[model samples]
Target: MTLLLAGVTLVSAFGSSFQYGYNVSVINSPAVFMQEFYNETYFDRNGIPMESSFQKLLWSLTVSMFPLGGFFGSLMVGPLVNKCGRKGTLLINNIFSIVPAILMGTSKVAKTFEVIILSRIIVGICAGLSSNVVPMYLGEMSPKNLRGAVGVVPQLFITIGILIAQILGLSNILGNLEGWPVLLGLTGIPAVVELLLLPFFPESPRYLLIQKGNEEQARQALKRLRGWDDVDDEIKEMCREDQSEKLDGRLSVFNLCTFQALRWQLISIIVMMMGQQLSGVNAIFYYTDEIFKSAGVNENNVQYVTVGIGAVNVFMTCVAVFIIESLGRRLLLLAGFGICCVSCAVLTMALNLQATVSWMQYLSIACVIAYIIGHAIGASPIPFVMITEMFLQSSRPAAFMVGGSVHWLSNFTVGLVFLYMVEGLGAYCFLVFCAICLVTFIYIFIIVPETKGKTFMEINQSMAKRNKVEIQMDKEKLNDFQTAAETPKKKEEAHSTSVL
Candidate 1:
């Protein structure tokens, strides 16, 4: 049964990853193609000669729009997952993927930019929904012993999609103006397969028990997940946790705002996401062609180099999956951030020396590649897994929504502003990112806790205990109250209430 659950989870995850790759790779291969097509077809038809500035702006828009759609789409997933259940929400999202592929593929054959961009927005929405729901679902469904490992699947599949996109982008067979549409359209295939396959997977047991209040179904789901013939004891334990009044109000956004534990968890998630974005990894992935060109690589060979970036991303993420359970999250994060800081410093130096020697360009490429490798090993997987771990059953979905929103918002910002930064700030851009990485390393060291082998409730209780101690210490500082508390009757009442 464990194997079955893992299999189903992997398949569902793969569909989402495939869509991710398609969106990322479409731009990598077709960047030059689009520029040429715009000049020859769109611009010529409008009797306007292409300006480099306008072309760059259009290219930026084409890349940034997906993240914009993602921002809105991620916001929608919280309510939908709460209402429809994970399986149902995913099923609907799969349809979102399929429709855009058909429209974009057919429209591109007819040479319609309007159709292509429209399709991209729709696909972006689908990707956002998957990104929000898949990690939450995987985290909730797995056993505590395997949660971190299972949660890493989404990140793994994301890198896998990057690899697939990189390979597809590099393929000479599909490296043309028309091939861009076909490549973009091919993202729908996994969605189609998922729509056909995912119905058999069980609903998340935690969601079933906590949100739906269906104990019997939750038990059946847990039994299947655990491969146990009898799960009465486990069900009772789950019920005991559910009965605690502490869990009831935690899911409310109002409670999240007021409660110390929830507040800290939310802050941690936001910080982790912001760190991920500010690391400049997405900028590297989305604008690999531009980065390579700036390194003095020939314009025609940029897509192939972009493929190399993707390959490193995919390979390093695989390394992360193996080490995550053994070496642990904190170590990986520290090592990854340290490496990124060094790489960014080197990249800045390489850019400063670009006029002196051609070899500096090669050095810049190496630094960027090293930065990507570090990200794959640490920040990429850790933030996602940690966010999922930080909340209790009641608060997990809402926390995920908050974290995922920050993530996509940062992604949109990086994608939208990076081209402008490249043009205006030049090498100083790497310096800014390097500074952010330094701060992130410090934050992780001081605040983020070791979650290895801990259950959801255990982690929550540990955080709550920490909050309780701080609250007690703050209360003890009341001087006037302390004088009044010297009275035996008042002191007895206070002690009694505390004991109760």
Candidate 2:
């Protein structure tokens, strides 16, 4: 973590992840305004009023576009990161935000509600690409010893971004009808900032040496990134290790899909990422106002409470960044998911009892806060960091693709069905989440290795016992090949002796 490294990491986080948090919550405060705009457009087009159900459907589509865009964005991660390089892909990703921001900012004047939907889709793509790329870039750039803390940087900014969005959503700022578009358009600012600043930062050294075969440039980049001239050992280390494991080219998502060797690592990341999203964090954010209302907070003060929870999320993640390397990934994930499991159960009971027991409402609110804390401490940040350490440069993007797709898919599932779950099972919807948390925790506690300070290969080899045997087999084959090649020289010397 040199200053330049820290600065670029922050720049990436702000440009990409900040937009993600912003988009996720920016719609919340102005839900009414946007919905009204939707209805007005429909009425103007049809020359008649729209049905409530239909209006709701349109509004749902509008809100849903962000995650949907993210889904599509996830699918593109492998190819984009592979072809464009992490830094280059992210630079191009600004188009998704800047254009959408304009559309969203001027949606009122354009008199086309469709542009708003379009804006959501574009900005959603922005969030999606950023979410996947920033983590991988930061993780690749970070030194192994400081990797965990530095890797968590994007997530820390994400929490801060969410907090900032929540604060900005207040009516006194940008949540008002006239102000909503401005709020929605604000996502573009980070993109512009990132675009301008990112060119100055060096490309990932791993990408340069391992992927591009530009060893000299890789060495230069590493020196700049590490703030030292003597990066020779570092370059040589990666080159030597990768010489055996290098693929013909960057692996495709399709190849990753079929690759047998990486199956378990792939599964581990898929589960961890899915677990991160499905651990009920977003559902908690969605349920906050009702929870606060149930706890006797007035409607106006609900925003304040939501902001407080956002603050808690930011604060806890900040704490996590400091403690991640020391505590190690496994313990933190277990603690985080374990705390969330209990918190979700408590939340279910509290919600169910709120009608019968007056104090139960307050208890539910406390549970909500506890759950957010639990999520931030472990579940929120570790999965992203773990993805980086889990795969080498060749397979990292594909791993991210799988992870990102699962993440957004799970998140989208929650958004689409959470209300129905609440209606069908009431507070017990958390029971489903509680079950998810418990099973995920058990699997991770038992299976996932502590990737705290290990190199990519060390973590991979330790993850599955079978992988060690496979690697050893490869080494043996290489040794045999070298021996066979040397046998010719021995025969040539023997023939010379016979001639003599």
Pick the TM-score winner: 2
Window of ten residues with lowest summed lDDT in model 2? 491-500
lDDT of each: 0.74, 0.83
Each candidate structure's TM-score, on Cα atoms with residue i matched to residue i, is: 0.86, 0.93
Candidate 1 per-residue lDDT over residues 128-148, each given as its tens digit: 888878888888787766777
lDDT of 2: 0.83
In candidate 2, what are the lDDT values of residues 228-339, reduced to their tens digit? 8866556545654465464334567778777767777787888888888888888888888999998899998989888999999999999999999999999999999998
Model 1 scores a C-alpha lDDT of: 0.74
- Give the clashing residue pairs of candidate 1, or none: none
Among these predicted structures, which one has the highest lDDT? 2
List the lowest-lDDT window of 10 residues for candidate 1. Answer: 469-478
Error of 1 at 265 (Å): 0.6
